[model samples]
Target chain A: MYEFFHDPIYFLTMIGTVVFALSGAMAAARKELDIFGFIIVGLAPAVGGGTVRDLLLNAEKVFWIEDLNFLYVVIVVAVIAFFQVHRLEGKRYTLLMWADAFGLALFTIMGTQIAMTYDIHPVMVVVMGMITGTFGGMVRDIICNEVPFLLQKEIYALAAIVGSCAYLFFLHLGLDEQGAMVISVAATFIVRGLAIVFGWSLPPYKAGGSPT
Target chain B: MYEFFHDPIYFLTMIGTVVFALSGAMAAARKELDIFGFIIVGLAPAVGGGTVRDLLLNAEKVFWIEDLNFLYVVIVVAVIAFFQVHRLEGKRYTLLMWADAFGLALFTIMGTQIAMTYDIHPVMVVVMGMITGTFGGMVRDIICNEVPFLLQKEIYALAAIVGSCAYLFFLHLGLDEQGAMVISVAATFIVRGLAIVFGWSLPPYKAGGSPT
Candidate 1:
């Protein structure tokens, strides 16, 4: 069990949380939500995964319940994004994709680490990693009235899974926790970033085509 | 454990599922989502709770996965709602409130029963009941780009909690399972219905003059 105040992992988790909050606020800005709505959506992505994780593990309190800093991060990021939106003159789609990719990678590694600490099965850990990485974005997209990218034939969740697998493999090879986290996060970011840059996608499943 | 087929409770659950599907489809119609999107939203409200329950309980498969009839119900309701949108002109708010209340009551009782069968603690069962009752609407509201009513100081979740308390009380008083369920569902429906009709609400929490 990882204690919140004393653990080095807490700082790493906070980084992931802040990044997720920024991405969520960015998404909410695209939807033109009010300040309150933006804050809510931002906090959802920042803390939603950890909330679900704690609930499933039957932990005493949700992460954000214990750490008001996470809430502060979400609120501050949302407030900053509201003002920064006009200054951000770049292509919206490109910025969104990059932010989302970074958030996905960071959250996936953090989720895998937390699940490992709980001593959950490896397969379950991979699933949790994917959930942690993708669910926040899924909620954000749904709240923004867009189709969730995860449901599309994309490499997004697949990249998270691949990175989680890498983490598991490193653990099997007796790598230290911090080393595994660095490698896994890097693997996820590279895989997803390359996929985005190269326009690479999983082959679409063909349905009801004429027999060849 | 309740068996899949031949149980009256199962039949009632199916009815509740269909009603929820109709409510979601009607909401989607108001939101002007396309046919596929409407169907997906409808199915979400219909099966989301059971799916969550199954996942948490580690059940063999999700209910809708094992029973295709639930899917058919959602599809049929969504199709009907889509084609009849123009003709179905009425007080949309009233209709939605009633339908949602019905679904909330039904699912809350069913969820409580299921949790009791698992020998879960009473407090946890109440929480599960509230989750089963309200999460569908929360998801629906999120997908529709609206703030979830649950997050508000609404009578919504309180109705479920009150009903869950009623169910536990009835059980303690030696009521039969069916009698307890009927009372619980009725309690929820009445409370929710009155709340909607009269605009009854919990006072917003005042922490430093802001509802925290």
Candidate 2:
């Protein structure tokens, strides 16, 4: 209990959880899903990434399954978001995007740290970080029958890669875990935020003379 | 090595891999995905479900990652599938559906047996079986930007459930592992095959006369 209270990762994970739940709720509302569907949507973004990460890493029981607090938060937040969908009508897209970016950043650092605990290749660790940060929203998008924003926007995974690398650099430089996490998370959030605001994105790839 | 050759589970799993990879390649061809995307699509249906089951069961490395044979089969079959897409144009849907049902049955029994190997609730084991059987096709559908066929057709998961129950029943009857697997898999595949041929379906859910 004391460790949970003092752990920065735990605290940030909670915030990310809530943010992701809201994102999921927004998608659910847009799809006009039933209560059961709403809850599924909410939970997908909140825990999908971590679940995939744990599975890929062959870690024990998925994080959220082991800790029910995360699902409880998702349920409560989803209920509120579903009821208030009418009020959040116009702002849903913007709100979902921003919250998603924050969740992505937090998870990127947290996931990388967890993967680094194992004796794996650094590149594999970085890919796992990106997967953990981005896969939840991918799950959300897929469930909602929408094209994944990840495929449409490269910045999402790119930010995760950069953030994971930054965290690694700080640790290599002998920075404390908390300090490294803070810096990388903040950097990832800023990059995504600026990209959203400025409409900045990498050019879409096209082979030969292909056009988008 | 000898056990792998003699094991019915291993042989069926290999057939399942090829069939699912072909199903994935068909979906990719329809979507006109690039080579990289095509491989991902093939790999998704071949490995996604086993990965999910391992994650849920908290098992050691997922089945595919632990064995290169599964991947090799998927790739070799997927390439053959991709090249033959033009020839398969008319037969794609029918062939994919049949192959998919076969894969589902094989995975369902295999997954259930594996989960039953552990000390878990019977109900949970059945659920894991359904998940392992259906999730790969779900992944393939999602990656192709289509609503999952599983959600549209309850028979997909239901077939797995029934097959798993059949396997359990046979085991309870003191049938050997090989006999139980054969009976259950054949039953599940036949059920799905009949459903496809007869266009058998459960009515879509609706409440208060609502329709999608």
Candidate 3:
């Protein structure tokens, strides 16, 4: 337990959790939800992805349930953000986007790493990584009643896929796990970061003369 | 495996899966999502609740993953509905509502039953039941970019809670499990059905001169 706290990965995971919580809170603010709504929405992104990943992998126990620290962090951050988010007004959207990107990057690497430990097919590893990185935000958007930016917008899941593949490639080349994780996270973050700044997005499907 | 299929509960579970799949596909049609989107969205409600319950309970495998039949059923139903939904244009809304109610009741009872096997508190069991019944529709609404009808309108989750409690109450009174499930399902379906038919809903929160 003592050694667990010292792990650098755990530090990054906490940061991811905090940012995701903030992202969810900002979304709740947009919806004009009550305080209870803020916490529920906030907790969605903070824990949603990892919970899904763990369930898919059939992990013995969910991480947050095993360690109350993550749950506490989400609740505390969300409550604080509820009081502070309104102050950001003009800048809240930008902050939320950046926070989501960072959360995505951190979660993508962590998920890919965990999946690798399970000895599943490499394709499944990348798929798990993407699910972990993207699912929480999707749930948040759904709860907020918006089309998930992940599905309709710029290369979001693609970025996670790229990072997962990059990590695998690096590991196959004998790169140390930590070094590969750092590089892969950078890969995902930079890709998503550039998409945000440049307004990059995939073209909408225009086939069949528009949907009903 | 043969005995598992022979169980009466499994039959209801299959009906629940089919209706949930149909419900999700109908939602996707409203969004005008393509076939791929139909499959993805349809799968959300069909398996989402059970998957979450299993994860929370630390079940050895998620129910759908353990049995591919559920996944296949969802996919086939979604594909069929993608084509058939437009035919029900005038009646689609009414059908969707009924489908959702049935799905809710079936999932609620199943979730409550599973939680009871875990020996948790009665409150947690009901909470799990509500989560199982409601989380899927919430996800469906979220994916469809609608504020969760569950959170905003009607006594959806409340119905699930009522059913869960009814099941618990019956069991405590020494009723058999199968009988308890049948009665509870009726309780939930009737409550939600009345809400739908009569347009019943919870009053909105209006504290502090409205939000935002």
Measured on C-alpha atoms, candidate 2 has an lDDT of 0.79
Q: Taking the tens digit of each residue's C-alpha lDDT, what string does model 3 give over B123-190?
A: 76887788888888777877777787666646687799899999999989999887888899999999
Docking class of 3: incorrect
| lDDT for each residue of candidate 2 in B45-89, tens digit (9 for 90 to 100) | 888887888877777666664466776787687666555566655
Best candidate according to lDDT: 3
Q: Return whichever of 1 and 3 wins on lDDT.
A: 3
Clashes per candidate, residues 3 or more apart or on different chains? 0, 0, 1
| Model 3: pairs clashing at backbone N, Cα or C within 3 Å | A142-B142
Question: What is the lDDT for B49 in model 1?
Answer: 74
Which portions of model 1 miss their true places by more than 4 Å?
A: A1-47, A50-110, A114-212, B1-7, B204-212
Displacement of the residue B41 alpha carbon in candidate 1, Å:
2.2
lDDT of 1 by residue, A1-212 (tens): 45334467677677677777877776666555555555667877887776677667665545564456787778788777666655554665687677778778878877777777776788998988888888877766676667877778668989999998998899899998778878998899899999999988887767887433
- Evaluate residue A33 in candidate 1 and report its C-alpha lDDT on the 0 to 100 scale: 54
> What local distance difference test score does each model get?
0.76, 0.79, 0.82
Second chain only: TM-score per model? Answer: 0.90, 0.92, 0.93
| Models sorted by TM-score, best on top | 3, 2, 1
State the lDDT at A140 in candidate 2.
89
Note the chain A TM-score of all models in turn: 0.89, 0.92, 0.93
